[model samples]
Target: MAEVRDGYKITELGEIPLEWDVVQQGDISVFYNGRAYKQTEFKNSGTPIIRIQNLTGIKEPVYSDLILEEQKYANPGDLLYAWSATFGPYIWNGPRSIFHYHIWRIEINEKILDKLFYYYRLDFVSRELQGKKNGFSFVHITKSLMESHKIALPPLKEQQKIAEILSSVDTQIEQTEQLIEKTKELKKGLMQQLLTKGIGHTEFKQSELGEIPVTWGVASFEELGVFFKGKGIAKKDLSELGEPCILYGQLYTTYKEVIKEIVYRTDIKVKNPVIGYANDLLIPSSGETAIDIATSAALMVDCVLIGGDINLFRPNQSIDSRFVSFQLNSTRKEDLAKLAQGSSVYHLYAPSLSGFKILIAPLEEQQKIASILSTVDAEIASYEQEKAKYEELKKGLMQQLLTGKIRVKVDA
Candidate 1:
């Protein structure tokens, strides 16, 4: 059972326990900011340099950039936190590395508290630091603010036990993520086999889409459905709550997934509006030169009614929407490149997409292919949900154990 005690309390984060002491972050740990190093001084190879961008986790640091001899350095086991753009503290787990000026290095006295325990405590208070900002703009965390931030601390032994328990949960999460990736790769291989060649003992013949079965025919997208472009809804008209809308600009890199909760436009005209019914397909007609064009197309799984910045394709009963969606997504890179236009901002126009050719099996075969792929999609979704649950469980454990509300036994 957890009993709550109070002094000056934190909002939404709850009250401190009677046995725990509430102290400034500076009292618990030492904080030092890194020095700025010139970009010209950065070398191709010397040592892995940590930067604000590289600060990801307290135990796991992702090193994407390198630095040369002329940079300030921090060693492994030191906690690094970003103070600009995004504010969250992370421990350095990489090899001997240097950091940019925007990052702060935290050194602790082990006799006072376990370093890992302080890491978890910092994680809990990260949101509080972020909440003090004025708006979406960059808010720099002052050294005084960092030092004055309060936290609940327990005895040193209990702190070590708490860190170990939380670390174990993180390990399990990482393993599960790897398993999910392997499963996805297996499904992709299966799709290539079944989709390219018909099931066992099937006849094949020459067609416009290559040597496909006699039952399969080549068809144009315009022949099967009405293709239209979405309206341009301005950013100012967006609202927190409104009808769900799909924006071509917001299409994901996977092209198969739909990202919701983007800026929504309520004042935009709703007529036709590129509203997608179940099984309807949508494609992007334009994009920047740097982006992959194929990733801008998608098929609607659920009924969504809103229109903004997407090219909608409503399939008739003659063809299966899922089949067309898969074919569009699987289009060869060279074919998409051929259709791409405009040097400044590359675009695959609606007319070009309508004219593009696709290989189509019989209606029954198309449905069967879609059914098989849908099962794989469901499995992927299940894994993602499980991953989310594990994350939430880990967060709860961190809150409890780090504060000594729940204690774990440590091996001596």
Candidate 2:
């Protein structure tokens, strides 16, 4: 390989300082495959089995009555690599859980390698490892293939320094995440209360939905706004620059609460472009789960073309669309789900949307409620931006520190 600098040489991974060594990852850390625990083995209480579902804290991982060999037990802060449908390196923070077959237990040879450093290194290249998985419907990472992967090894002190730097960023991210969760809880309460009880109201009245403020009126979604189903845009019709478009899938991924910017634009011919109007709320009409895709975002301008599986709700001037969207998030999701069709992917059709009832206030009152909630949304966005900036900084540091472009001091 050609020398990149006087003290640096290009290697298989990348350019590195001459002092550092490139070695097989297996040489530094030994990997053990987890036992494939089955449904029949599940018990009400025992050691919690870490499943792919539990990775996102979606569901509490179940327990197993059957005890496995010594190597299978995983503890808090142990490094684990999950490879199947979802792939990544995770510092196991849960209890002493029996891991599923999809996850691997990684043991560092402390004499040569630091656990945190290798975890961060594995995290840095997790996407690359994920790409190595073989399967069409599902991906699997074999122990043999992962053991042969290469790593750029640094001195123990430098490795610890890099890990410390990355760990500090992770600490900031964790704190920010907690703050985000708290802020969300606060916002949710505001949505539920403000949308129903309203601002500073002493009087209350009962209705089919629930008891709401006396001054507030109840209305079907049809009365407050008009609903439209979007057309399906074929893959052949997509391009970089064309008429600005909003896709159904994007409703779940992008565009939260209030959207001032649109991400996608389409070039291909559209039969009937269901252009977005001012104050039009867009949300997924169908998704894997009703609760997940139930969220909505309101547009502030006229945009052309809306993709299928998305339902558009254009509120009349009498109501604030963003306010109503927040209210839906707080209340109407379960109601909407009740009307959803299909089993696998629940769909919210026109009839269901029209029949849905909501507690409403006057236009000015609606605007005031929306403004108060928007302030909370802005605060959450600020925290998210800060967390993202810290993550970006860590990513830049990893690239430099791992490659040895920037040197870290090692104490004797």
Candidate 3:
């Protein structure tokens, strides 16, 4: 007994505009599965085979000398869907290549539906299905099940308008992401130069670490700071509204070189909780890889709870915490990585870090270097925020326009 609006009607998908039609995915498009390849067929160079990893850009592309049917090859502008491992619609923007069996080359009936609009529709449907999966990390939709899925569609003109609007927002998001990456690259280059060469330094000297500015000196971490380990708290100890907390894993996944804010909290009452201090540097004590354990962030807020598997470094008055963080991430990353030990899970203990040495410039120069890097960090943060907003806007627009909740003007 759902109430329908004046110009809206109830369908299997709840309620949509009266003019919209609910149709099976197969009715409007043909999903051609890509060809499978044997390991022996793989070559060093040939036509690139698109796999689920390629869609996500997580793995290097594998090439094959084996030729496939024309329908198996996806060209630029063709809509593609990854059905296994990862799920989603991707309009192939890469060069014409053979797509793996796990992917589907969607051939839309453009006469009845716009390809880009259907692309967005497929994406929306995938999200909805994923939402209903109940905590599962991933769910694979069989070809028959995917084709049988029902979706509500608007008129061709309305579909085109919705696609155009969403595409514009996507473009904004992509451009902003590109800007963030470029700014980060600039920051990386700056750190490499400033941390080693020092600003306005012409003279250089060689130390156990490497060649550095003459004025700069190397100092063991133990001499610059006192180390302590966070104890007791675990991921299960976290809560939404409680004391702000920092977990060791967050150093690699959440915070940057400088922690401007805290995002997690815990309500669990622990006797004498390990509290963080301003200018205190934090690094993970354990991680999946040695390099990951080497990541560090300078805590700016005081009195926050420091969780277990973390190494907290309280710098002396002479040291710039931010400068030390940037140096650890750039110059001493490998040196610290070499010290990390374990079989499957890497561990970085205070004893290992006690004698770990790093470049130390004059206090003034350290602050100056930190300030320059901080400015770039701020720029990257702003761009990331902009990209997030654009992505959110796109989500809202898709929820409305794709469901006919919001209508756009169409040409007469």
Candidate 4:
């Protein structure tokens, strides 16, 4: 960790390191707020327009459905940052295009620092800017504020070296993530084949749940276990402490039903809050669109599942919860589509879910299948956890290296 020195003059931030120089963002780069292009002016034929909606901090840029005239655009190398609710600075690699006013384009002058180096610098300082925002309504970054923001800079060679080191780490993380994704795709293909056609068996029979072995039987979801909807807990009742709760937003796209975020209720007033025990199956009853939510259904293990939007199915001893969860997730496409009621949003009722049928194999077979799938799931989870740790490390390094607090030597 770098030590803070007292000699530097007072500015927006208290003090700085003596060796580092303080300069406003504008002094380093040309800053411009994105221009607003009229909706009618947008056409499908021209260049894609970057929007706040398309700006994910780490992911590749997604082109918006709307496009604008080529003249109103940011160049390929310019850095883009969102001014809206979710804020982070990222390098623009997509085609040159216009963007909504909610974004800002930062074009760095080559004499000051490497553009790639500053891209990471802006990313590091963005956290401070976000913390200063007043409220959630319209958290934005003003061009004036950005221009006045101070940063430490090093020699040009050092800037390139630091950016290269951090960029290498990023590349490794990205490759690991890609590998993890490929593993998941492989598992999905394996599950589709294994669950449908048993190992070493070529024949399958037509059943209500779809094609299956002749030995398998069609069973109702109710027959597998007890089903109940989650109890309602008002937002006002939530707390930072006390009993932990899961929200619909915490669900992940992967098969692992890991809860990434939680809300707590100190009052503990709600009764039968649909608390789940290990080996319970949880399914989302409603979502923005039918089948839009990934892992909308998942198996619970060693975690208390709490959410009004989720439905809990406690399977009896005859059924393995993991196997049931896998079957539900795999077969839910058609069922969820049928239960979808609204035009804009799709929802499923508990009654409708309870009426859905499932295929029941012998208890021993269920356990065997569950065990096989669980092994694959465990591997996938390990990869995900590794990726998360790498991402956190990358973020921390970006905060330090990008600001020139830690300097690197460049060969040039």
Top TM-score: which candidate number? Answer: 3
Of models 3 and 4, which has the larger TM-score?
Answer: 3
RMSD of 4: 4.8
lDDT of each: 0.67, 0.81, 0.90, 0.68
Q: Candidate 4: which stretches are off by over 4 Å?
A: 1-19, 57-71, 133-137, 229-278, 284-310, 340-347, 402-412
Better of 2 and 4 by TM-score: 2
Per residue, candidate 4 scores C-alpha lDDT tens digits across 1-412 of 4445444434344344444567888888876677776667666556566887666633334344454454347777778878777677877677777777888777778986888888778777776655654622355656777787787776677777878888888887898888888888877886786666655665678976688876677888777778777766655656777776655544544234333333344456666567767666777766787665424444454445366777777778787776666765675455656666666766667687777776777777777877787777778888888889888888878766665445555575
Please report how far candidate 1 places residue 194 from its true position, in Å: 4.3
Ranking by lDDT: 3, 2, 4, 1
How do the residues 166-186 of candidate 2 rate in per-residue lDDT, one tens digit apiece?
899999999999999999999
Please rank every candidate by TM-score, starting with the best. 3, 2, 4, 1
Writing each residue's lDDT as its tens digit, candidate 1 over 96-215 gives 877777887888888887877777777777765555555223567677777877777776777777888887887888877887898788667766665566556367887765676667
Which residue window of length 10 is worst by lDDT in model 4?
254-263
Model 4: colliding residue pairs: none
lDDT of residue 212 for candidate 3: 87
Can you write out model 3's per-residue Cα lDDT over 1-412, one digit (the tens) per residue?
Answer: 7678989998898899999999999998999998888899788999998988888976578898877679988899999999886899998888889988889999988888999898899899888888875522465678998889889989999999999999999899989989999999999999999999999998999998889899999999889989988977888988999999988878878899999789999998877778898999998899999888888998899889999899999989989899999988988898889999998999999999999998899999999999999999999989999999999999999999999988899998
TM-scores for every candidate against the unseen true structure: 0.75, 0.89, 0.95, 0.78
How far residue 304's Cα lies from its native spot in candidate 3, in Å, is 2.2
- Number of the predicted model whose lDDT against the real structure is largest: 3
lDDT of 4: 0.68
